[model samples]
Target: MRALTVKGVRIDDTFAEAFGMRATAVIITADSPRWAHQAALTMTGFATSVIGCGCEAGIDSELTAAQTPDRRPGVRVLLFAVSTAELQKQLQARVAQCVLTSPGSACYAGLDGEERLRLGNALRYFGDGWQISKRFGGKHYWRIPVMDGEFVCEATTGLTKEAVGGGNLLIMGRTAQTTLAAAEAAAAAIAKVPNVIMPFPGGIVRSGSKVGSKYKGVPASTNHAFCPTLRGAADTALDPDAACVLEIVIDGLTSQAVAAAMGAGIAALVKLGPRRGAVRISAGNYGGKLGPHQYHLRDLTP
Candidate 1:
């Protein structure tokens, strides 16, 4: 395979091994885009990874009024979990707590998959006998009265079993600030890619973790090799000139989408020029033991 390189920055030829996840797309709509985003951000909060948060989710994209079921501004958010049961639990809790409470917000099934999970069917109880069910083109929605008005939510949400998660790229730079800038630019570029989401703070992870931890109770710990201060002490991955590193993690509806997102992020970072301080692009994996999907950096490069 050809080695990956752009603007003199070395791109590791290894793959970012990812695994299949149970994912569902949620459509949250409100009176305006601002309110739609408010619900989206809240629902996806603290969901950077399944290892810590029990789920992973992010805003997939925004939808125009014409594209939404209620003809309102909306956002598409994806939630991924290790199993369908866990995913269903998360969907119920998040939508009820976040979207159902957001001003003028409504929720609907974003995907048309056959496997469904209850949403409004369970939340309607909050109305205490006043909730009404409406059928729109065969889909059921419940209107539960709230303080402001009624909160409308669909009866169920769809699921995809083979969704891929944990695709990532590492940016090594001469300074922490430079590494972060490159990561931010890469995230902006990745955001434009369809069907994928970078589920970390500002789409970047400063504390990337490895699969195992030194402590028995913890399943993961900070990736010591990537730590600039641990260069000599911890069998580091950095070069002599490297001073800091940041990682961009991506989760997508399909393997193809993940690869496309990775390519877009790398291309965006390359535009910053090699002299901008980012000297290398790498990936994280567990020697092919972690997941079945392998996104190769070499294959993503031109």
Candidate 2:
């Protein structure tokens, strides 16, 4: 396929294929911002991919005291899963293990919808018959005893079925250094957009994968087509000059949020241009068979 040039950068005539997912959000508040962020970081750990981790989660944004239900500093966390059952399980487990154990931490609903997932309702059993239930300001909450003091959590949190996952951008460049810089810039820009999470280490992935592997029972394998070292031995998709590649995968509460994130990331790459940023910008897809949502590169390009 021919590549379209924008400010000396090549934009592939491709699209990112994404699929439907179930998502939920929760707020973890504490006496101070430090502990709140610590709990959020711990809860989101080892949750970069649904294939391995059963969920994809990240700290969506930080919240001020005025923005939280308990009037304390907090962090809003978002989790995505392939199904509602998996999302509900992850939410309960993470909150029980991470947030409840944190000092002075409190959990609350961060979203509102008809579908609800049990939060404190599932965890009140941990209190060993000492849990206290109360209704205040038209919301139900549970107070469970703990060493620090008590863990306050909402009865339930709203769930949204409109989440989109696997929206990606592939950055190919002449060197790893330039490619990494461009990826970082795109991540920073995407972080400013609300309701989306990158869900990868440092918001960048070096080991992008294809749908299947040659070995039996292996669900996925490395994307050898874009590997710089396999240029001669394999069917390559890279330009002759591209020496390194990086990918950014996104999950959002809504389809519009994902598209906005993609547009922001592409604009950041365009601002750096080809010399300092990516030589080519493409996307991963399975010939429109992977998912229903297709984010075209041309439409996202600035």
For lDDT, the strongest prediction is 2
lDDT of 1 by residue, 123-236 (tens): 999999999999979899999999999999999888898799999999988888788888888999999998899989989999998767879988888899999898889887
Local accuracy by lDDT, each model? 0.89, 0.94
In terms of TM-score, the best-performing candidate is 2
Report the C-alpha lDDT of model 2 over 70-181, residue by residue, as the tens digit. Answer: 8999999999999999999999999999999999999999889999999999999999999999997889999999998899999999999999998999999889999999
Show model 2 residue runs off by greater than 4 Å. none
Q: Which ten residues in a row have the lowest lDDT in candidate 2?
A: 1-10
TM-score, prediction 2 = 0.98
Model 1's lDDT to the true fold? 0.89
When summed lDDT is taken over every stretch of 10 residues in candidate 1, the lowest stretch is 1-10
My TM-score estimates for the predictions, one after another, are 0.97, 0.98
